[model samples]
Target: MNTLLLHCRPGFEGEVCAEISEQAALIGVAGYAKGKPASAYAEFVCTEPGGGERLMRELRFERLIFPRQWARGEFVALPESDRIGVLLQHLAELPVFGSLWLEVFDTNDGKELSNFCKKFEGPLRKALTKAGRLVEDAGKPRLLLTFRSGREVFVGMAETGNQALWPMGIPRLKFPREAPSRSTLKLEEAWHQFIPREQWETRLSGDMTGVDLGASPGGWTYQLVRRGMLVTAVDNGPMAESLMDTGLVTHLMVDGFVWKPRQPVDWMVCDIVEKPARNAALLDDWIGGGHCREAVVNLKLPMKQRYAEVKRLLQRLEDGFAERRIKVSIACKQLYHDREEVTCHLRRLDR
Candidate 1:
């Protein structure tokens, strides 16, 4: 295969194209990306043989900000008659796969194919197992079958431990009924995407104290309270009575932009509705001032030049920290629950 398939949120095809093209050029790979508006996926065609595979190996998927899942492969035309047979025929030419995922675009049409993919997986698995082309080894490459249509499919391979844990890079999280708003999933998903699960006990322990900026109605604060952490919620609006009743939160009526904790906190989270740069600056001040050891904040993006703006904001933070001689690690992602904004995690490395 000479192309890399990138899956992203619908209406963000342009961003994915821009991001992958820039990333590929940085690695000395010559390629061009093709994406249709609202198609929910993009493709990068390599200029040379095996260039796509090289990018897959050399590029750290975590460092990529746009694409949720990626694979190196080529498109294969399938006939409706004996589709399984044709798939197996192609599999014979490739190495054995650890597992298989049948995915479609993240659009209305794609949802229609969910049932088809589900029905087709069982027979395909049985056939691949019989041919010794599919195994249970986690170290083996994962077979990625992205169905653009019933008759057209992209056959790709994703390296184990180098791709998102879920298909299409989306984690399935149910909204907690107790949360005051659905916005709570954003923080929950951010935790899953940014922090490693093994470190949750120490990093998100009950003894840790936190502050939730713009915490009205207690959506983000709800996550902290459930984790058994003491929280100070800052907002002009009143918090949910249910959250206040927990006695773990102390609600303060103040502007998040002007509010500062009296002492350093274990964590600080913000979901304030404001400009991206403004939100970034708030995070910088908190982390640089040592007001919080770690922070999770959402940056609301502009409608135009979104990717460029994000890079600029990230670079600004890096520069600000360098000038202050403050060491910290920052990671940002457009979580499944986010809309026009991206969630960022900043942790003080000096601590």
Candidate 2:
């Protein structure tokens, strides 16, 4: 039971594997990752027994850029009959868990297995309860049962606070029809991922002013208006009529790259389609020049070496802040709603 199973977005298994392999080596845990690209999952098999626990203890899931969720456990192939007995027998070898989650991969084939998982969950939970392998204590690790098929399953465990907030790290955010475009979900998901919900009241309020670059059609602007914010929307393209009616927006028919706010605003968000390096530089200028207190920018990634490019850009951002003697905090993620790009959240913590 020394294998670590990780769930990731389809087409990014290689990036996830590379990241885990590098982290494993850095933490003194020798391991190898196995997974096919576009399979939507990866398995990191440790060299020694109990190495999975060591790796999990040493690594923080939040630091991982690619994997949405990871669990440490053993892989098992169930028998054709008496699947319950086989599962219980295998589960008996591990410690009792606080909760249990039956999951499938994030792929099309995985979606086909959902019905089976749902049908199997009740009986399995009852059996585990009867066998004293499940409990309600938050201190205990969560038992993750990921099914590859009817005959195959992976038994893994993760600490409560150490894993993603939702299954497969995908937040269940609903899109409001009031927003002009579905692209609004990208910014919404970014906020959920980057900003702690509890801090929204103070950091994101109607009193604060903001600017949205490339605000055409008003997807991101809708979010700001809903929060009761006054926003200067910069874009030559047209914005949604509904957003303008809110009386919360000021449209500027100009280029986002050349435009600058008349005064330092509380927030600056960009969703322009541009090279990631250029966007990184733009964000640096915004923070360094004191044009905005915080920003959420999207960087369009190149087709190959996406992870490597993000690493380099992030390092450059850190250096840019350092060179200007600016105190800032930055977080970047390949969001669930984002494709071919990664979103960056930056905030100035000091004057």
Candidate 3:
């Protein structure tokens, strides 16, 4: 297998290709990416026999912003009469996998295959188990079977810890009925993707205070209230009556761009609709000035050169923080709930 399969949001295949190509070049790997607009996936074909494996080893998956999940392998054509037998024959040449994930693209056509995948999974697992090619070791590589169509599939492998925790790089989160708007899921998903579950008690405890910029009907503020935190919601619009009833949120009517908290806050979150650079600058000012110990904000992307724009904004934040002698850990991702924007988490480290 000399191709690296990558899963991404539909219409972002070019971004994925650009990111992976650049990352691979940085590591001295020779490869070219093939992507189609709205395909929901891309492939990087390596020039050398084991170059795909090398990229998988040397490149940290978390550092790449575009791809959600990645695996190194080749495509296989299966026969309709006996797909399980064909897969087992191929597995005979590879190492035992700790887990198996049967995935499809995130498009309408892919959704149609979900039932087929579900039915295929049971018999495939049974066959792999009988062949001693599937086991229950978390440390082992995960087998990735991405079905492009009924007869066409990509067989790949991803190390357990190096890949996304969910198949197709998507987390299935149910929208809370109590939230004022569906946008509330963005912050909830950000918490899941950025904060470690074990550290939630200490880092995101209820005693911590938070500020929500652009808070209106209180979608983002809803997350804070549910976590039992005292929140100062900044916006000129009225907040949800349900949220006000919680008594944990104080709604302020003011422009998010101009308002500043009187004192430092434990956390600050913004989902304001603004230019990416402007949003980034707001975050910079808050973190560099010690106004907030941590922040979760969204950067709305431009129509063209989206990847380049994101890279520039991220570098700007890093450089600005360094110049100010600020110590902070920054992480960004395009969460499933986001559209035309990416979420960023900035936490000030103890000096």
Candidate 4:
């Protein structure tokens, strides 16, 4: 009777969880409960109960919830005998240690998530039981929005505390997915939201041009070409016919970093499979030598020391640009479709 909880990026929840199910079963756990859009939590009862250690080994989820299936997410193993109130007590560690967020699915038929929050409110608070995870003396709560497909939910959590209640119903697993881009990594498209399309558009003095490194199959280039910009796609491989057809792209049969642009372009885009410093230096020469004005690039992370590698890459770029008094903004995030890696946005200032 062990319970397992799961969480995923909002709009991509269905797809993410579905992918989780596939990944989980492959790792041996089975019989995952389907998510009810109305409920804040999704349940998985492992009749065989593979245990928490197993889940962690298999599922690379953000977090794993257990006990009462009030689980916010992570497919943890829960003993069936765990009580609801006791679960809340166990949940106390959540507010203190974990990054807790209240997820409400009500905006788009999110009544179920709200209902769970309300119905479980008593036991949940009681479960907190004077351990005092919440900050009563503090200011307003902190929250953010999460979405899956097109359905949206508000995520809130007590500041200084870990657990907060979801404000809404089970999110209806309703919205259809957008057209699939090749490779689940939609870093280029996701970048549009972090920084406005307008920032790139307006700030781009002229109809800017760009280079899409590793531009074969063209996921990154597709995004660039769609923006009405021309791209020099550098790769030995042929570009995707669709991207090539866009007429906004030029396939350059050459190494991306080694091949310098004939003249300066507005931007440099890369999703090349290479070491971080190599990519960093490539960007350095382009922006450093004033070859391009702005750039959006992806530094693929290897299995080990990913964060540290990225940190070094950022530091190097900053040091390089700073030496010349160049200004830039850098943003990084674990995009909905990203796996074990993060996407970054870097904009060299137009000083």
* Residue 39 in candidate 1, Cα distance off native in Å: 0.1
Candidate 4: tens digits of C-alpha lDDT, residues 238-302: 77787777677889898776888878887777777777677777777877788777776666666
What pairs collide in candidate 3? none
Residue 183's C-alpha lDDT in candidate 3? 95
lDDT of 1: 0.91
Residues 74-158, model 3: lDDT tens digits: 9999998898889889888889999999999989989999889999998889889888999988999999999999998899999
- Regions of model 2 farther than 4 Å from truth: none
* lDDT of model 1 at position 275: 93
lDDT of 1 by residue, 27-82 (tens): 88998999999999999999988899899989888777778889999999999789
What do the candidate models score in CA lDDT, each in turn? 0.91, 0.89, 0.91, 0.52
Whole-model alpha-carbon lDDT for candidate 4: 0.52
Instruction: For each candidate, give its TM-score against the true structure.
Output: 0.98, 0.96, 0.98, 0.53
| Candidate 2 or 1, higher TM-score | 1
TM-score of 2: 0.96
Off by over 4 Å in 3: none
